[model samples]
Target: MDLDVAQVRAFVRTAEELHFGRAAGTLAISQQALSKRIARLEALLGTPLLLRGGTGVRLTEAGRRFLGPARRTVAAADAAVAAVSGADRPLHVDTWGHLYAPMRTLARVAGRAGELVSGHGRDLPSVAKALLNGDVDAAFGRVHPPLPAGLAHRLIRLEPVDAVLSADHPLAAEPALRPDRLSGGVLWAPGPLDRLDFLHRFAVRFGVRHTATSVNLGLGHFLAEVAREPDRFSLMPADVPLPRVPGLRSVPLTDPTPLYAWSLLWRSGDEHPGLKGLVTACAEEGGRSRWLEYDPARDWLPEPPASGPEPV
Candidate 1:
């Protein structure tokens, strides 16, 4: 039997997300249209692919089995189209935090004329939204999962997270500190990271109180806050050069430090002619960098319990 590719896509996405609203948002379609497409697909198969009781949706046994073949079909279709057309569009790339050097390399690979919009998200999810909403073509950030159905990701680099404290603090003298040592102390962080469930759970497990601030403090103010408060701390990238602040100190976090596994994310099958080259640029830039390493084993963050779908 022939199947409509668009209807199949709608069913697959809705099945993955289990929420019509989110799936529709990802596909840039109305929820009603998405539901209708799924209903049509179900009619064609003469079986309910999803179990929509009351609270939300869950896949039927058929859906669980059909998902694999459905994905393969979609992938093959996209590949065929890409091979035939070989069309390319101008790409937009963006990121959060200080990922400038490697992103500059990406811009060069995208083409000197390609647009690179920086600071797209305060955190990863916002960046994912920008991609879904067509605000940007590509973005760089952490790869938290239950990601949308049609997004592609490449692990670019592992950025080491370290501790920032007052120079006069007792722990500052240590070459490296462990999470247990941070117990009972407060870690002041930018709002985004603190709001993440993984970080929150990890902090609680380690007995540290992670406090997020709404204000984006300047470097001077950041240092002042660390130095002025005895019980306060912050996190930073260990390999990145630190400013010489007399009262502030940066120390390595040893014994399983958290590494921000930076990745490049874009919608799969979109295949801008320059996207492949831009990814190559990120890989080569990651290769030459002394600070960023490609270690998948050490690049993971703690996973929190799944409540709903996570993006990026």
Candidate 2:
């Protein structure tokens, strides 16, 4: 049988708060509206759920019984909806960042029932807006100040930023590299990697001073450029495997570089079955498993960088 999720949700919130006024505030509606919703909900159930007295309000026998189990039902319904939503998509997203490999890996784990694709697109701000605007299904990237609005997020993975240096560098040959070892090398960085302002804001935290030059180039291009420079190097999503750019190679640098977390994001009101399915497929991947297609012959590991950084 179909259930009024709105009614159920209202009931659970009010019951937990134990006060209609407080619950109304929590639900971001007025007390009168909340009372009416509860009344409608009780009418549908054919029973009285709450009783108001001088001491405020209390659940009735039916409501006491319903309160305990109804919360579970609401949560279950939310889970079911989340499942249906993530698994209901044939389309995909490719925000420029490090979440690509793992995102694709999730699709593989979801099996043939779901089809996933990855492509480069607009900056995080715009892509996040696009997802909220129903342009794309989801985007993966970091936002320092938190997402603006009309968006829902689930963090998929954390990618450490590594000080990448040319293979010929003295530290590049080191097995265990640290930040201090990276001192004095010419640095390459995205103008804004995960909105941390590239390595500028994070350098002090990392205890390493870097000379920023190619901050405007995207991650892919920066890596390629760093690969070309004989003595130049940069920082990138460490987990993502970098492909060989002919004369270049990348190795980890030591320091307290910020580890950027990328999350799966979508518009709050987007309920398209295709998009939802795709989202669920991604959410299920997490770090426990990966769901992407990797090409090895290209000098890159299974799932290195997905998209480039935004142009400064």
Best by lDDT: 1
Tell me the alpha-carbon RMSD of every candidate.
6.6, 12.3
Question: Taking the tens digit of each residue's C-alpha lDDT, what string does model 2 give over 93-165?
Answer: 6565442244433444456325656656556676764553334666666544456544666655555556666
lDDT of each: 0.67, 0.59
C-alpha TM-scores of all predictions: 0.64, 0.52
> What does candidate 1's lDDT look like per residue over 1-312, in tens digits?
899999988887787678999999988999999999999999999999999878799999999988767765665566567557845544567776642233433443454334444555766667765654445667776677767655778776666677788877778888988767987667765455544544565577577865655355655566577777767787765555566777787788766677655668886655555566667666566667742543445443554223422233
Q: How accurate locally is residue 138 in candidate 1, as Cα lDDT from 0 to 100?
A: 77
Candidate 1 segments exceeding 4 Å error: 16-32, 68-86, 92-139, 144-153, 172-184, 191-228, 239-248, 252-259, 265-271, 291-312
How many pairs of residues collide in model 2? Answer: 28
> Worst ten-residue run, lDDT, model 1?
303-312
